[model samples]
Target: MFFVDTVEVPGLGNRSYLAGGRTAAVVIDPPRDIDRVIAAAAQRGVRISHVVETHVHNDYVSGGHELARITGAAYVVPAAAPVSYERLAVTDGDVLPVDAGIALRAVATPGHTPHHTAYVLEEGGEAVAVFTGGSLLIGTVGRPDLVEPRLTAALARAQHASAHRLAAELPDRTAVLPTHGFGSLCAAGAVPTDASGEPTTIGEQAAVNEALVKDVDTFVADLLAGLDDIPAYYAHMGPLNSGGATPVDLTPPAVADADEIAARLAAGEWVVDLRSRVAFAAGHVAGSYNIEAGEGPGGQLALLLAWLIPWGKPVTLLAESPEQLAKAQRELVRVGIDRPAAAATGTPEEWVRDGERPATLARAVFADLVELPASAILLDVRRATERASAGYVEGSRHIPLHELRSRIREIPLGVPVWVHCAGGLRASLAASLLASAGHEVVAIDDSFDNAPFVNTPAADRC
Candidate 1:
């Protein structure tokens, strides 16, 4: 009777679990790190009965679908899930029989994202534990603003209602095993951890979680007050979870010759140099994007580089060999930038001699101080959720990146357009988009939680 809690940390995205008796196991809220889950099941010598998701996650790409493909297990999600979930969608009071004397029950616990649920495991007539995904964290509940538009009022009402429902329903003794723990962003307040910083209990959470204040109204109000900045990539995450678009895991077929690579570069293919910073600086293609494969699973900085590079342009991957390319692809897919083209033939020296063109673009941080004073217009290319989470830079026009294409005419092209996202990815993408439309533009990396904001060249920032 061993229950395994699979902790996929750091570069992996989110945590998950493999729980059950000897005959079968159930997985919850899987991230892209499917290998770990597979290995755990192998070690335990149990077939995974089903992959369960507590809610549609926005923090990282959900690996439940991919895991289901690998394990041949049932992919069970909530029926209230916004999109087509390709598997058995369970509703409240629904009991999924796993094996002899074991069953999983889905209890509707919305607020995180409308259809959120907490799965309770009943083994041999005793409720074992509840798999609280993002709904209830170590010391906090799920944020309602992830789906609900209004941050303050709307999210408050939703989260408050959801928490009260969970608190009132679940039995006190049910062991609570949640998807995210101490370090997860799902918890708004400081995560409650054990002495050595591990996931605490639900009983502990009920006692001290600030969001669960005295009454429903105050709890919701407090939730609305401290919402964090919703990542720019979140808007695309939910749809992908519900089977909107399949990720193209583009790994180059095989390593090619330097001359052939050089030819491709000369033909105007963008280079994505997946190498170490030292190696890149020593010698690399003139116009290649530097993203090292050694940075570990999902190099966040590397992913940020991918986001900043001009979208819609042909990308040529530059890695030492096919093995490196495979690793780079893993990193790229972790962040949703799938199927990057293989690197073209040739070393940096060869490409230089061939007179391949350098990728050119003007970059700036697009702060209102500079643009407003100079009579240039400042455009906010961040999402509504982002604006609600992290307040927009004062006086900046709000035109989210997704709507930028259609809303371009609203901005005067004659004046220099300054653009920015919550951090910098969307800003870079926005700047490139504006540049393609013939607007003189600059993208800036603002909202850095550290260091006094400084101005420098794009090369330095990149």
Candidate 2:
């Protein structure tokens, strides 16, 4: 008998798999935190015999090396990948037997990267599931533009061919498990989710996935045109994965006093407050950025930091408790934002002991925007696709959160700016950025769904 379990790294928007026979199992595309995988295997009473990498991921750090080392598993990787580490390099058509009735067959499926492979798990001589990684996603293939600009067009074409190949070779009933399409930026476009918001199968996707139905040239053009700004941290992930990255250190960061934190902030280092948005808006250290450790939609620390913060900048973390600081550190390390320069945990009262007043921002809801004075500015910081699908408040200035830094000067100074995104997370971050730039800002820390003008015009009046 064979069984498979999916271990979701919700913060990173990727899923790793543990599949095995009764006695042994294989782990695929694990995140940097390996403890979860180990625990999952322990529960199943199976020794992990192999660890597989579908590709050298560009979005998050890989835990394959560390997982394999700890479990005494064969670290399996693509034969074409350039790495100095010891691993069992696999090629297309290579098959590894996991146990008496189960085996994983390698299928070369390159597109998201120059060297990518998908593993088909067969039980009792029948195909059961294919771990498609970034190649063949739930509703769309992985974006081909993460590599060099010159290779994007060619890789997109390759992506289309690879998708067709998988569809042709695999039976319709084969379960399609992918790593990139579930709210990750690695995909070319947004994929629809099931009731549980998890990805569906190859059979279901073939009927609905637009990429599968479009011509190769059209698909390639559309994929490239739809690409958004790559996160600055992505450039660091590829190299780190190719060479092995050290196992993440989840130890609590050393506590720093207010004086040290102030000095660091004065030095232009990021002093992030990982508290609730409500707590942050009420009071926080002057010059601190509010990311809110485990709040908002999924509250992915790595994704938000990578997308917003400039690369290689030193970061200091401030949280409400030692546990909060430790949790934030674990999430940040998965995306290679390891080892914050300093950390401190305390209430705003404790932090403001030096006769310094903590900064606060005005919080508002969508209803307040209706009676806004003409002098006040309403800035929508959601992505273009979000604005298009769910209409924005009319007359609001549109600038995505990722582009806010470069375009901050466009908003006039001395104006009260009200900032909002699909949810309150980006809005809080944007409000902090705007405030740092000397604008009077109000962050709308509420769900956009509750906003009356999402799908209708404003004149209709909630």
Candidate 3:
């Protein structure tokens, strides 16, 4: 048997496979790009017989249905799935025959999603590996709140029972292969730790991982607290992954020239600039979102959307170069923003002037805060998702940077506004948006220290 793990860091997800003697293979949690899965199977002279989904994911689009459509492999899921799809569904105690001596057993593990399941691969009745999707991670368990609250509670309970079942029923030697690992928000807390920093043993996880089989009450409490606010786009992306709809072509559409990109931008299209923050800081088109893809993954897309465009607006692409725009489009799809407006065909300098917000805005806001009235609102326009994960300055009204345009009426124009994001990137963007709308705004640099905002000392009065 041969096993391969494909990590799609671009999509912030993972997929794995089990190849038996180069003739047949079973893929688990295939990424949105199914070509790679096919390519891997072909390399080993194997054909994919089954495409397995441990659970319906909410983070990125799933390729299971598409893979099955292309390869004619059976799309397998838990029998209890409420959603409809063209495939075979199995439940606990059910075993899928892969070969004369090899089989995959479906074990219902419903914490992340109600119908979530895991596969225990057995060879000659010996358990070799168990594919735990969101149910179990290296250092954590799936967050129960990914679904309805009532269902989440039930799944949490089911997760506790299912984890114990795996710990007791499977052999200690069974290799634990999960769909996600460190750095994924799907998990609960710190990643699983081993001496070598590689995947750890189930035995090690059971002993140290708090979510493995702890008491139900403690398990539920810990799971809920760490549940960070999901990105605004997830509401639109999850259903599309359940095979409900097709994603629009994200490839930058062919345009006549820079005017076309500008026309799209003028029509309120999302323009994502995938330049370095330093480059963007030096100059970028007005109203264009700066992802600074140069910044490492994880929060690249989130930072781009939360800061550049307000929530609930369509997306368009604007990058430093054509290659950068193409790269940014793929990242956008992962977060559910498809068919980004036609990208700027020419250089960044061709579309707009490179001037930045007057340094006076920051200097003015800081000076005003020292003697500002209590009624002067110090608004932190960062997304709720960003603010919760990394604590925010106390008492700041969080009208996400993107929503500032729509909700500007909510704020009294006379009150001073100071906005910010994780770093100063989005804050600067937010400041620009507020300023254009005739609001007195300043962008503050993120300071994670647990201190009150420098000027508004009384604002901290809870």
Candidate 4:
């Protein structure tokens, strides 16, 4: 019997899979944190025999090398990736036996990247599943623009062809599992889900995937038009993955005293407070920035911080406990934000014991908008597509969170800014950014669904 297990990286909105027969298992597109994959294999009483990558990932660091090293498995990658490390380079029509009655066949499926590949899992000579990676996602295909701006149009067209090829070549019931499209930035937009809320099969996708049904030209245009701002850290991910990123070191960082943290803050280093937005809003180091530690809709701490923080800037983490600091460190290292400059764990009161007062930001709910002064401005920090579909508050100045740092100057200096996003998580991060920039800001830390919007010209709402 053959079985498959999904390991979800919710912070980046991606999934890695472990599949195998009776004696051995193979890991597909494992995350930088390989411990989970190892644990899954151990639980199933199987040894991981192969670690496979679909492409050079652009979103998070890959753990293929580490997993292969630990398990004595063959590290398999597409022949086209310009990788510096040694591994088994595969191409189209390559088949490798993984275990008794189980084998993986490589299928050339470019579009998400120039050299993307998909792996078909065959059991007893029958195709049972295809790990489509970023090529053929749940209800959509991976965005082709992550590699280069010049290749986007051509690759978008290729994406259409790739999806059709998969549908025609594979059995209709072949299970289609993708590494992206579950809120990952790699997707063009939200992929529609089935009524059961599970990933649909190739046959279901052929009937409903928008990119597969449309002409190549139409699909390319739509895909390109729907793309949003690529995360800043994405530019650095490919190189790290290709060159073999160093193994993540999860050793707890050296704890710093309040004075040391203060000195670092004075030196213009980022002092990130990893507590709840509510706890942060109540009291925090005057110059600290609050980006909550654990899971949230906005994104994971590692990916979110990697995208938001300017590259190469020294960061110091502040959490409420040693465990929180350790958790944040593990996530941060996965995205190449390895080894924070320093770390400290304590509450605002403990850090401010030197007679210094902690900083605070005013929080507002959706209903509080009515009480704001007329001179205050509303700022919508959601993606362009989200604002367009949901109809944002009329007359609100739009600046997606990813683009907020560069476009901060566009916001008026003297006026109070009321900021919001799809949920309160993004708004909290934005509010802290605005506060750090010396602006009077109130975070609408409430669901946008509950917020009121003026019924005005559709153009203004969008």
Give the winner by lDDT.
Answer: 4
Error of 2 at 36 (Å): 0.9
- TM-scores for all candidates: the values are 0.67, 0.93, 0.80, 0.95
Point out where model 3 deviates above 4 Å. Answer: 10-21, 99-101, 189-197, 244-251, 294-296, 302-314, 353-419, 424-462
Model 3, range 1-462, lDDT digits (tens) per residue? Answer: 545455444335344554444467788887665666788888877778888888777766777777888888988977777556677888887888776577788987877788889888888888878889887777567777777766777777777777777888887777777776545556666563222234555687688666775797898777766566555555555677666435336556554245665566678666666665455546556656455553233445643463335545766656657776766666565555566545564555676533423123442333344555577677776656556555556676788866766787887776677765655666666665665556775556544342355223344546
Which RMSD does model 1 reach against the true structure? Answer: 7.6
Which regions in candidate 1 have their CA more than 4 angstroms from the true location?
7-9, 32-36, 148-152, 168-176, 180-197, 213-219, 244-270, 278-283, 292-298, 301-314, 320-324, 344-462
Root-mean-square deviation (CA) per prediction: 7.6, 2.8, 5.1, 2.2
Off by over 4 Å in 2: 193-199, 295-297, 449-462
C-alpha lDDT (0 to 100) for residue 340 of candidate 1: 61
Candidate 2 or 4, higher TM-score? 4
- Give the TM-score (vs. native) of candidate 1: 0.67
Better of 1 and 2 by lDDT: 2
Q: What are the clashing pairs of model 2?
A: none
96-179: candidate 1 lDDT, tens digit per residue: 877678888888877677788888888886676788887777667766777758544665566666666666666666666777
Give one digit per residue, the lDDT tens place, for model 4 in 1-462: 999999887778788999998889999999888898999999999989999999999999999998899899999999998899999999999997999999999999999999999999999988999999999987789999999889998888888998999999999999999998777889876874222255568898888887778888888877888888788999999999999887888898887788988898889889899999999999888778888998434446886789988898999999999988988887887788989998888888777648788889999998998897899989999888788777778778899988898999998898999999877888888888889888999998888878786444366654
lDDT, model 1: 0.64
Q: How much is 59 displaced in model 4, in angstroms?
A: 0.3
Ranking by lDDT: 4, 2, 3, 1
